[model samples]
Target: MFDVAPTELLLVAVVALLVIGPKDLPRAMHFVGKWVGKARGVARQFRSGMDTMIREAELAEMEKQWAAENERIMREHPPAPSLSAPEAESADGADMHDLPPLMVAQPDIRPEPVAAEAPVSEVEEPKTRGQGEHPL
Candidate 1:
């Protein structure tokens, strides 16, 4: 994270060894590593929380769009009327059988015959370029 090259890190280590001494250098390095690891863990947790919130927001928007489309479809094609109990059954408790029959008509289609082409006649010999024009 500090962008330290190998040579620069070596220089820093030598200085740290002279200042902090060899005995306490390992303990100080260990403590710093622990703090860096904790900072990374917190950053990872925050990133995951933001990702979860973004996903939930996207899902909520999709659900709203779906609901709007469903409502539009329902408005476009309303439900068919239901027959009442009295209308479905006759007075003597018999079922009614008076539904009208449906009629569908289809047009007849036929292919027409193709006409035969006439034979081509042979062409006569062509005249020279100067035959039909006057000299300039």
Candidate 2:
């Protein structure tokens, strides 16, 4: 990056105007432009703190791979044994024959009656040439 060329930057500005002399060469080029703007603001804050620690280590490795894929999909789908009414009685507990009969069908959800919309007549206004109408 130090390939200075325009005739070696005009021979380093004629040897820094003959060893910084034009009355202190504009305060030595304003102290080398304030230390090259504080070394480019500390290299842009160390490249945004190494891009925020690489996006927090890639969001903590995608939350530990989404918590190990939600614990392997809850250990391969395991959750359906609820039964309740006293576990559907049976062992000489006044028998409900280990429960398995619940039907339930009611779904007609009635709502289909909407066809009556024809009443909007009023648009006749274009008759202004009756003096032997012939403007073809």
In candidate 1, position 51 carries an lDDT of 100
What is each predicted model's overall lDDT from 0 to 1?
Answer: 0.89, 0.89
Model 1 regions lying over 4 Å from their true place: 1-4, 83-136
lDDT of 2 by residue, 1-136 (tens): 5777799888988899998878999999999999999999999999999999999999999999999999999899977888666645656776576567778998989899999999998999877787789878
Q: RMSD to native for every prediction?
A: 9.3, 13.9
lDDT of 1 at 6: 100
Per-residue lDDT of 1-136 in model 1, one digit per residue for the tens?
A: 5787999989988999999999999999999899999999999999999999999999999999999999999999998888665557658776566646557787888889888988888987976678877766
Backbone clash pairs for candidate 2 read none
